[model samples]
Target: MTNRKIYRIALEVEAFPGMPTTAAKLLPLLENHDSTASEIESILKYDPGLTANILKLTNSAYFGIPTRISSVRQAIVLLGWKRLLQVVMTICMSPLMNKTIPGYDLPRGALWQHSVAVSVAAEILVNALKIPDADEVFTAALLHDVGKLILGGFVKEDLQQIESMVTKGITFDVAESMVLGTNHAEIGGQILGKWCFPAELVSAVQWHHDPESCDESCNLSDIVHVANTMGIMTGFGKIDQELALEHFGPVADRLGLAPENLEDMAQQTADRVKKLMVSWA
Candidate 1:
């Protein structure tokens, strides 16, 4: 895990720039608090692929409705708008959200699974706290780790050094800085910002690991951070000796999430993830 290897991997990942979905049109639609079912269906209609994906997902293993859902309108009526929106967004994001970075020992779809679990966990946590705009909360959760696709190879290239630092209890962020020259959080933040996502969502992705630096108390980062740690421990994300237990308790305390409550939230979140994958699949 030398700088040379790290740079080499970073170059490969950058050489093949990703093409994410055109989300701006959908973003405003998602932001519409009072949007009707027809409105949501109309907005997604712009992308036939997105619409087809959603319909296919609604009939997937996750939802398993009694009848097939062959259209956006039918899916919306069957799944409810909130759940339908979640499925649509997941479909919209799936293409760009996938990659393999063996540095983290993540399998082909491992990172995607981890991200989905964490996103669902974050939303569950938000509901337990009765936070407002729960849809927006989940949206932020779903997109938080996108930066990892860009930086995972960089991290993988230096995997050995990262492992070495972890053995000595060094932080991933600190160890990465020492080896990779730039950290994933910074890279992730930059990507989100460049995409012109909601400023708050971008901020959460940027600062998820460090709750103190996040812009707001009720931000999605705090929720995602807790969800991510729980994902690792609960087996959604890959577990490594590199875990920083020091980070979790503080983040939980900051968000007024008690240990018992956090435990229940994690369980519920994992359950929902099972149902969620059906639609995504």
Candidate 2:
């Protein structure tokens, strides 16, 4: 629980391979209004496997595109640049995410399923609440818990102490910090920062488990926090901590979400995740 230990963990995160090369290159381009579809195509063309997966997702029932998408260009045009970026990131990150995390007790594919569910739930909240400034919300929710990948081994080493704190009524993440001096949410933010994601996106991952710590001007963290809770409620993610619905009241009120809204969102999230996972799997 020393700074040296945390420093070593930070070194490991930096050493971890970041996003796929092509996907990394295309992220900023897509975020820019001046960038062209052809530019995106140019980068993706080299990664035939990624291009094929993108096309596959576009044609998948989850997207609901009426026409077949044979090429990246066609998919880009139909899904628009932003949606295309989401699909590209999803496909690009799936391999890394679809793994077991011993620290959190997430089995192979469990983390991916939870990540996808949270992403879906985040968008559902956005539209339901009629919030307009959260274009990065989906990706933020998807990659929210990515820090588990790095911290799993360390967590397993200290699981006993962590669990003891949890039994005493401290939240799991808080226990992680008390025992490890760093929790998955904070490390996840570091991972995103290494990937060069925007500050808001990084904060969303950092403060997801403790939205109260997030800057008040940004609600992306609050959105992801609720979505993560919803993901656990739907039984998609690992749940090491006791969940208290009332704990979310303040964030819910800020988002204009009623208690009933969370229930409705949980149901809708489950249904959407079910269909998407069927096709995605």
Candidate 3:
């Protein structure tokens, strides 16, 4: 019964409408090193609302631009295409993520805030660790809990059984899997796969809660795991005040982070997330 139910919920990911058209188009472009600013402007111009939000975010204090950015092309020029793509992705994701999530106990905008926080945390980790190949980390971190959107209803239905397991000293995600046959991390990977994301990114989300289980994308998974924990530790994106469930030591060691490095990263992530949320709110 649990397996069948999990299969049904997994199938629902195909119908999830949260990935905006602009985002879908832009995501592929982010991978193309040859993608030009005009190319980005072309896709965004059709979605004026997204363009406007992109401009607003580009001009936000987070980017530290000295001049005002009034146009997409101009913004792209000033912020560079890669940074502009990240901003566009953030704007495109906000509407769906801002909605209140049921089972996770996230209020309207809370999940979005937490996602942004995690994304920021991921960026900080990549820079601090100087992992040059981690360009996909931000997107992976942003969508790590996307499974919650699909699984929330099911979780609500099984809340009592899942909560019972949690009370027995099991972590929430583990309890979720035991009671529901799958957890959000696995479902989140399914969602990303349905969206045609890169394999590494899919792996990163799939094993974010269990980095040790991810072989090929272990480093990426480890970064996202620690980033999600940092988001929770900074007091954003908590599932009903649930503590950071993943152990910090092993993942930190894999990432070559000492305790003091984590403290510094946490402070930087919190400051950056707070500033970014100003425009996001």
Displacement of residue 7 (Cα, Å) in model 2 is: 3.1
Candidate 3: misplaced stretches above 4 Å? 1-4, 239-246
Write the number of the candidate with greater TM-score, choosing between 1 and 2: 2
What is candidate 1's lDDT per residue for 1-281, written digit by digit as tens?
A: 46676566456545644434545565566566576777776777778887777778788766768898777778867897677667766776777676675556676777778778877787777777776655666666776667677767667766888879877978777687778776666667667666666677777777766767675644577777787776665577755522456767777776788887767777777777777765555
Cα TM-score of candidate 1? 0.83
Question: Please, what are the lDDT tens digits per residue for candidate 3 over residues 76-160?
Answer: 6788756876787788777777888898788888888888888999999899888878888888999888889888889889888
- Cα-based lDDT for every prediction: 0.70, 0.86, 0.82
- Predicted structure 2, TM vs. truth: 0.95
Q: Which of the numbered candidates is closest to the native, going by highest TM-score?
A: 2
Over all chains combined, what TM-score does candidate 3 have?
A: 0.94
What is the alpha-carbon lDDT for the whole of candidate 1?
Answer: 0.70
Cα error of candidate 3 at position 135, Å:
0.5
User: Candidates ranked by TM-score, best first?
Assistant: 2, 3, 1
